[model samples]
Structures are given as C-alpha cells and as structure tokens.
Target: MEVTLLLEATENAFRIMEKARAHALGVLDTAVQFTGEQTRFMEEKRWQVLFAGAQRRKTRFQNFVGTALILFAFWMLLSGHFDPFHLTLGAICCIITAYLFHDLLFANVRVGDMRVVALRFLCYIPWLIQQIVLSNLHVASVVLRRKMPINPQIITFKTKLETDISSITLANSITLTPGTITMDIRDGVYYVHALDQKVADDLNAGEMEDRVAHIFMEADHLYVEDVLDAARIYDALRV
Candidate 1:
C-alpha cells in the first residue's frame, strides 16, 4: 500500500509540472507576439516621418537651384559683361539673391518638371511671334485707315490659371501683342485694354489662356496636342 501511494504522488507531481511548463511557454509566446507588433508599428511610423522630411528637403533644394539659375541668367542678360571677373561677381550676386529670396520665386509654382515647362514655352514662342506679327499688321492697317477705327476699351475676365507664373506669362504675352495690353490682374481676374472690338473678341476667345495652362500643366482639360506633349515628356523621362 505505501509503495502504491508513493507512485501515485510522483505521477501527479510530474503531471502538474508538465502543465505549468506549457502555461509558462504560452504566456511567453503571447508576450513575444505583442512585442513584435509594437516594434513593427514604431518602425513603420519612423520610416514615414523620415520620408516626409526627405521630400521637403528635396523640394527646398530644387527651389533654391531654380531661383539661382534664373537670377544668374537675368544678371548676364542685363549686365552684358562677359569678362571672368564680371561673371564671377554676377554669379556671386545671383547666388546671394537666390539664397535670400528663393521661396518668393517659387512660392506659387505648380509641382511639375521644369524641363517640360521650358520645352513647352520654347515651342510656344513661335506661335506667339506669329500672333504678334498678325496683330502688328492689323494695328498698322487700322492706324493707316482714313477713319482710324480706334475704339479703345477695357475688358475684364476671370482666368482659370492656378499658378502665379502662368498668370504672369499670360499677362505678359497679352501686353506683348500689339492690339492688347494687360492693365491689371486681381483675384485671378485680368483687366486688359483692347485697341478695338476685334481685339476684345480675340481676348474673349480663351485660346491664350488655354495655351498658358498647357505650358504649366495646370489645365483641367487637355487637348490632343497637350496629351501628345505629355506622352513625349514621360517617355523621355523613362529613358
């Protein structure tokens, strides 16, 4: 009887120890899983924060470089000095100005490839020149007429352009044309002085505004030419 009681007690103790070990292992596994999830969450958040900061830094750098290049070009154009000493001084001034006012130049700039914008603008120049020539001839004809046909009037229209650069470009283009001058721009509305009723009708046609929007990639509606231009830009970038 004593031997049997001792055997039973030993078996029960062994079973209890086996159950306790399994419970401890279960608790440890749950704790490990929770810790792993927490670590992953923190890592993801850290990566997101780092990526946002990097993007901000990149945009700032781009703005600075763009500003510097424009200022340098303007300096060269206005100074008309090609000597090394003058070039160096101009470059230094441009760099300083860019550093001080980079944000101002790009403050309302849309997010797009500057190269694409430049290429489009270059393409637009020929068309603009043609328009200017046509306008000049028309103006000359009107001025040389016996009646003079001079009915000057101001016309106001709200523009769909989203960025300041596009708006300014459109304004300048109008002023460059012989029959029209951009009097003022306020709250996205342009006030233009037209030399005659024909000029006013042409301004109301909205072709110039559309072209400006296309150059800046700010158009809500894209023409076939605009689509082709965008496709070409994309392919070039991919290469």
Candidate 2:
C-alpha cells in the first residue's frame, strides 16, 4: 500500500512540471512576435522621414538651379558681351546673386508650369514697351501745350495682384512710364502720382493689372482673350 501511494505522488509532480514548462515557452514566443512588430514599425517610420527630407532637398536644389539660370540669362541679355572674360565674370556674379536671393524669385511660384510664366513675361515686355512709347508721346504733347496742362495729382487704388513680386513689377512699370510714379504701397493700396487726369484714368482701367495677373497665373477673373492667348502659348510650346 505504501509503495502505491508514493508512485501516485511522483506522477502528479511530473505532470505539474510539464505544464509549467509549456506555459513558459508560449509566453516566450508571444514576446518575440511583439518585439519583431515593434522593430518593423520603427523601420517604416525612419524610411518615411528620410523620404520626406530627400523630397524637400530635391525641390530646393531645383529652385536654386532655376534661379541661377534665370539670373545668368538676364545678365547676358543686359550686358550684351559675348567675350569669354565678360561671360565668365557675369556667370560668376549671377551665380552669387542667385545663391543669395533665389528664394525671393521663387517665393510665390504657385504654378507648376514655370515655362508658361516665362513665356508670358516675354510677351508682356513688348506690350509694356508700346505703352511706354505711347505714354512718352502723350507726355510730350502735354508738355508742348500752350497752357502746359500739368495737373499732377496723387491717386490711390487697391490692387488685386496677389504676390509681392507682381506688386513690385507693377510699381516699377508705373515708375518706368512717363507720367506715373508709384509713390507708396500701403496695405495693398497703391498711391501713385499721375501727371494728369488722363494718366490716372488709364491706370484705373485695370488693363495693366489684369495682364500682370495673367502672367503670374493669379487672375481672379479671366477674359476671353486671356484664354485664347493661353491656348496659343500651350500650342506653341507643344510644337
């Protein structure tokens, strides 16, 4: 009887030890799975961060290159010197200027098609030149008048232009004309000194503002002519 009881007790002890061992192995496996999932999550987050940083760097590089090229082209156009020494000097100056002020040129670059903007700007130059000539003649006529009807007056108008660059361009264009000067720009309002009432009326007509807005792709209202011009520009580019 005593030997039977001892055998029963030994069997019970062995069963308990086996169950404990199985439970420990199951817990270990669960821990290993959780650790692997955490590692993968961290790796994915790291890759995402790296990719975003790379994209930002790429955009900045493109902007810098574009700015440098534009500066160089403008320098060449203005200097009109094709000699190697002058070319090299101008290139250096443009590179330096672009490095210093690239952000200013591209600050309000909202449109993806920079080529379109450039073409539009080039087209605008001729129109601006024509306006300047017409303005000169008008000013000349005013000066040659027997009474010299020089009625200089300050006119203020709120501009619809969106960007700082566009505003500056408008201001400079006004100053470049014979009878108007951009006196101050305060809170989107332009204070201009016009040599006569006719000059003020011409500015109030908003043709110049509309053209500037079209060039920058920031027009609030598009005209039929603007749409046709844009279509023609796109067709020319495709060819």
Which candidate tops TM-score? 1
Model 1 lDDT-worst window of ten: 230-239
TM-score of each: 0.65, 0.63
Measured by lDDT, the strongest candidate is 1
- Stretches of model 2 off by over 4 angstroms after superposition: 1-49, 71-105, 220-239
- Tens digit of per-residue lDDT, candidate 2, span 1-239: 53345445554655575576557556755665767866656755665676577556655665667687778878989999899999999979988987898777777667556778889899999989998998889888988989998889999988867778888888888887769999999999999999988888888766677678778877534433564564455335435
How many clashes show up per model? Answer: 0, 0
Ten contiguous residues minimizing lDDT sum, candidate 2: 230-239
TM-score, structure 2 vs. true? 0.63
Q: List the residue pairs that clash in candidate 1.
A: none
Tens-digit per-residue lDDT, 28-99, candidate 1: 556667677666566556656765775576667667776888788789899988999999999899889989
